[model samples]
Target chain A: MENLAIQLENVSKSFKYFQLKNVDLTLPTGQIMGFVGANGAGKSTTIRILMGLMQADSGVVKVLGHSQPENQTLVKKEVGFSSEEMKLYGAKNLAWHIDFIKSIYPQWNQAYANELLKRFDLNLEQKIKQFSKGQQIKAQLLLVLARKPKLLVLDEPTTGLDPVARHEVMAELALILRDEDRTVLFSSHNTADVEKISDQITFIDRGRILDSNDKESFFENWKKIQVELPSETLLFRHHRSIGIEQAGKLASVTTNAFTPEILTDMQKQNIKVLAVEKMSLEEIFIANVSYRRQGE
Target chain B: MNLRLNPSMIYKLTTKDFLLFRPFLVVYILICALAAGVMIAPIEGAYYLGVILVITVSIGSGIHFALTSVIIEKKENQMSFIMGLPINATDYAVSKTVGGMVVYFLNWLPMLVITLSLIYFSHLPNGLIPISILCFLQILTGVVVVLCIGVGTGSEGFTIVMVVIFNILFNLFLSVVGQLPGISEFIQGNEAVFNATFFSVFGIEILALILVLSLTLFIKSRNACFL
Candidate 1:
């Protein structure tokens, strides 16, 4: 197995109204893991725990082979973090932040920082407070990326950016993925962005991890099958599958285990298949959250 | 693994802090100049020094409290950035403490020079060296204790409370000591009290430094939740 850059074993955190229970996650070296969750699905909370910013109530969190809260300083050195909520000095210009970070991290890539600065169309002289939301996001990215950390943990890096800025940020991240040794774990509610760049995707809902797999395997396993059930029969009720919805005699089935045998089995049950459609990451996310919410 | 405190990194942080404190520097200089004017206007030497000391300490505490609590942390979102940095949190905390101390020293330097000039011009009977040494030790001890409180409580109001209480207690303790009839007689009879007290204060100052350093390291190691 490739060396895992991040590992969370049976991690759990609890609050009065919300609880993250038994969240197990693993991001091997050199893979971009997109964490998909709803607004209050505990995405940022998990990321914060992983970054050693917040401690998990119970569970083992190891990043870069260092135990968290104890070895956070060592782990932080090799990890680059950027988030929507993290802001730089408002009065200080970009150059000042650049110089400041550069002074700390000896591995800072000056050329890469300059390249990103040019690409993001951010002037070093511009005060961070005066920059637009998009520009600020780009500037934040610039600061983190230049550190050339082994792992990058980003929380909603493109949440408030316009389409063009989002595309710019996504494209830059894509270029970073070209390096086979760098690992990225980013959380986003925007499934399109996740779909575009993630090698692995994990869906979280109501503080529980609903599904996690490689993007290819996840796509391969889940299918939205539209079927017409016989008027007198309930076909989905007898099926052993992950999710199924019946509206009158018409049934829509989503299976975690999708194969040629499933189709044949459905046919044997006298269900006439109307269409078998591939589900996008967004559809999978919504279906997962909604299904769990409905207590399915 | 890269855990050394690079001088360049400290320098950068210091410079950044200095720049952020530019406006305060101007105000501090003005205050120091005003204090110097008071000291040099042929006033009684001890009274002028006492007034200048009170004013300097009050202003220094206020500025330090404000800078550490409201301005610096608010401006950089420094808690997050500093937490994310590769350096140990203890080092980061120490950097802030040292940075504040440097600023505090800068604020006092002008006043010290002015007081020395006053002594030289007036030819006061008091020895300038002992007074200067006492002032230095007092200020040094005050800065460390105040900065530790600032960093530990992570609030300006807390620092203010601590400083006020400390000043009150210190004044009371001094009053009590001075009232002991034999204490003054012994001090006046022997020249060793001045040196002993100065050295004792210096030793306590060092102890305070060690205590604050250890506490800061503990705080950093705890990895308390921060935005």
Candidate 2:
């Protein structure tokens, strides 16, 4: 528990229109976990709970070894929270904001803030409203990063960036998070964005986490195998496979629990194995979501 | 949980909001000073003109302050930025309420003093003081009502609507208070009278202000989720 930066067990919340069922999550320190979810998939809601902006209806929530909502003030001091819904006072410049924030957080590192000011290429004196959307996100990141927080909770940090800006933001995050002492919970709907920098990934949909694993485990365990269709097409099926796509003499079977044994098992059934293809993160997410919803 | 305010953070947040409203405050104070000057001047018809100017600007300042400083946080999507800081729901609510009340006093206090001073220093009837007190209290209460609604709902539209309603009610309050037996009989006397009618109305106004403000804070504290 001490080694964990965040822990949520059977945490649940209900609203008039939606409900987050019993949710259990854990994130060890020094890991960048991409919280991937589609729109309104409870990414932001869960993050808000972790940040102590909302109280859980039941169960436990602890961040950095402290209880939630109860210790939110203490937790908030150590956590840097940024979201698309967050905006700085547009009437004030970044410099003014920096100073205001600095006054509140005793641990605010002025030297790092100065360095980030240069690295992010933000004009300190310009009002935040005058900044382009990309610059605005960069400014938000810079403020969060310079705080030198124990954990960074970013909810959809790249939702509205253009391709180039997205690349730049991702590149900067990848570079900065190379330090193993800091932790991050980066949430987004874009699989490519999560795939780029997350050491670990947690996929959520409709208020439930579908899957959570390391990047490699996700890559290694899910696969799309190309095969030649047998005369008895209906006879080609595997217990480990979640879905299949067939076209004439060709067939592709997607398996979540992939193994060399599955390929061997397929060949014994008279289906000619062509090749085993690795699935992209996006493909795996879609297939998994589709399979889970259909099965439920 | 209790309010659990960190004094330093609350102070910073309160000051931050106050600074944001300071420029508007400067301009509004100027208008207030001009109106006060006119009220005290010996120029013909200046007192009546000054009375109208001061009353309008007094209410105007409260509405402006509530619009810009209180409701604008939620209206402009900046509440998340504030909530992201090292504070809790209670801290945000208290700081906003404190800052909002400051706006209320900035305009109302000066006008209160000016009106009371005019009756005391000049040859005007001192008995007008009770009515003057009621009028100032009405303005102060109006601002509180607006501030409470703004803080509670963070709705600019509803708060503005209430502002209009409060102004209309302010005029009606004057008519009703003028017709009260105790106030009407002694309105022109040489001595100022503080009657039961004055006490009754004053008590309710004060009670409403305190209750409304308390209710705002209570709701915010009890509702843990700010976002």
Candidate 3:
């Protein structure tokens, strides 16, 4: 955590009905971390703490080497935050908002802003209320991106956007993220979006971090091994096997520690390997959650 | 004050509220001008009407400013965008209170001068001066209440109810102060006398204002994320 862009150690926050307990996270500099969580999975709450907008009941939160809610102003100068709940002044035009932001941020990139306006197909003179939801989202991104912040903490930024709109926003992020020094913590329930852009991914559910690993490892380790079982009497539990479900002549095995030896071992046991299929992030997330839920 | 509190950002937020209420300020000027013209007019009963107008305008303006700047901002969920900026919670509270109270003062001071000047030069007893000043002080206290409720709690219904209740209490307070024996004896006196009762009441108002402001800042620090 010493040289990381973000770190949260044993962070705990409790509300009336929900509690985030003993959360520890670390995202090194120059990495895009996709924070994946289901609805009400403490995604926004954790991001709020990182942005210095919320205080943890007990924990250490450091962003850009400054403690949160204490060094918020100092750290916020270099952090760009955008949430789905955030909104611009509706009575004002986009140009007015641009000017207002430009006045505040000394490093405001007007040329980049102008480029974003054209790319997002947004008009400057029109009032914010006149824009559609997609346009408003693009406008928010433009404001956050144009400042060229060191860290971007986005909470469900593409939540309600259409497929095309989501693509446009994701593409914009992809283009700007070429800078090796810039880091992004993008949270979403949509695994496809996360899988497309994230170098590292973290899974959160019920206020707990279930898993965190690199994108390649997630795809590499999780697999759906379809098998042809000789009989139903066999107890199929491999050393690395997560869960096995059999339907008479065939059994499907889910594994997190998939390897070539596991297949060879299955063949020695007289089980025929029909196919070894790689798991999508979404499938792996569902399988992981279901498997975890079974333990409870 | 925390070192993280940014003065420039506070200024930007305060000025943004001012710009948003530009129409309100413009109407305030026009209303005061109309009231002034009426106060000095030769028409009978116009001065009374003008006094009522000034009081109404000041109170209404303060309530409107609080509703829009504090209550509506939260109801519309604009506080999220604001908290995204480079500002501490305490500083955000300061900006709001300063922004609302400064406008309230701008509206209050002029009416104070106009009403007191009317009493001083007119046939109304000079004894009314201290009472009038105390009434304006109470209005200032009422504004602080609105700020505490609207900014601190972010409750619109509660703030509106408080404003209405304060209006009734204002009249009761004025009548009660006017009936105090030590001050009532000089009710028709030619010169305004500064009594111990006046100072006692003034001291209480100042104490109340300070306590309310402190309470607001405390709530803001805890309620930053809630907002």
Candidate 4:
């Protein structure tokens, strides 16, 4: 297949209050990778490292085949980034920002920017401070997307946006990804967005990556199973792989390695299966965090 | 991918920045005009009008330029947006310094011409031209230093503290030395103060430019994640 567009190997960083440990992430050249994490989960930190905005205290980070913080100039030319904390000049209008970005990026697509302007329903002449929060987010996206970079790193692009605005932004991102030549890595607490557009998913918690895999495999691997156990008997008492919650004789078990063979093994132990349910991304995310916490 | 700096883009941003300061510009002009009018009055207070105007312009330009430099980026959260562009951080910092210098010069020109004309006619401060030039250079140095501190630390309180400390130290030095046993005579013996002031101002200007350049390099080498 294609070479990875972004790669991180055992990258780590530390602050007085927080630590990011051994974050390993890989995004193939033509796929959308959704970064799923709760607040304070180090998702932004990881993205920042990849963008060469922050250096890793240890390990290696490569974006588009160039080492970061050293070759950032080369990588910046091909990477488009937007973050919630970032803003345009308050005195500048959308048109001014557009022209400014156009001047710096030789690959700027005027037609696309014009289209985004119309699509976002933004007046080119109105100063940024006058725009609503959703409009501001749209304006930010327009500025980044118009540059037509090969890789787009967006941090919470839809945060604080209304449902309709979120949909519009998601739709636009999806449309951009259809080209099969561009890659996107977007971080969000909203799992639905990730579930809808991501080909690969990485879930991070407590400054460490919990899981990273294809979306389909992630879903296929995690499952919630209900089992009916005999009174005073525990089917998962000795099972290390199963996360068991027992209420009376009914036990709910969540497993990351779910399979028919595992279920059959449970049945052999005289545990009656009540239900086998597939876990959603949200459920998996919560279970992943809870599971980590339980281990701690 | 396209990677080129666009002057049109810089111009657009510069225009926007200028527009934001339009009201302040008007206020500054009014103050200059009022001070000039007051200086032309035949009164005892008119003696220091030229000096007052010079001081006003210096302080006004320094504070206004510094405030603009600090607040513009923070207000808009444009740091990331600018960093995301193809241009390096060094270029970005240089552009800002150049932009601030342009605006400062534009604001200072009117006051300078008016003050000089009035001084020429009134025969006050016989070396008004040279003194005014020296004052202008000092203020320019102040602008550069303040802007650099603002960008590097990204804190208004810190910049204010630095400015206050600088002013206090300079004034204290002047006061103590001007009263020294033979220092004052030595300083006046060969117009050393004037020559020293001119050279020091020039030295500061060059140093400011160098500091700005180094800051740009520091920004580029810094991890983007911290920013």
Which stretches in model 3 have alpha-carbon errors above 4 Å?
A179-181, B1-4, B35-49, B110-134, B178-204, B218-227
Best candidate according to lDDT = 2
lDDT, model 4, position A293: 79
lDDT of 1 by residue, A1-296 (tens): 67989999999999999999999999998889999998989999899888877789999999988888567767887999888777778878999899888877889999999888887889999998899888988888889988898999989999988998888888877776664567899899999989988999999988889989999987887788888876846654435465777888888888766787877877887888898889988988887787678784
What DockQ does predicted model 4 obtain? 0.48
| lDDT at position B19, candidate 1 | 76
User: Model 2 — TM-score against the truth?
Assistant: 0.92
Return the lDDT, model 2, position B20. 79
CA RMSD per model (angstroms): 4.7, 2.7, 3.2, 4.6
Per-residue lDDT of candidate 3, residues A1-296 (tens digit): 24799999999999999999889999998889999989999999999988888889999999988988788887878999899988888888899888888888899999989988988889999999899888998899899889889888888999989998888888876776764567899999999989988999999988988899999999899999999977777655787988888888788999998899989998998889999999999999988888777877
Q: How many residue pairs clash in each candidate?
A: 0, 0, 0, 8
Ranking by DockQ: 2, 3, 4, 1
Candidate 3 docks with a DockQ of 0.54
DockQ per candidate: 0.38, 0.74, 0.54, 0.48
How much is the lDDT of residue B33 in candidate 3?
59
Question: What TM-score, to 2 decimals, does candidate 3 have?
Answer: 0.89
For candidate 2 chain A, the 10 contiguous residues with the lowest summed lDDT are: A229-238
In terms of lDDT, model 1 sits at: 0.73
Q: For candidate 3, write residues B37-68 as lDDT tens digits.
A: 57657789986687677667777777888787
* CAPRI-style docking class of model 2 based on DockQ: medium
Between candidates 3 and 4, the TM-score winner: 3
Error of 4 at A226 (Å): 1.8
Ranking by TM-score: 2, 3, 4, 1
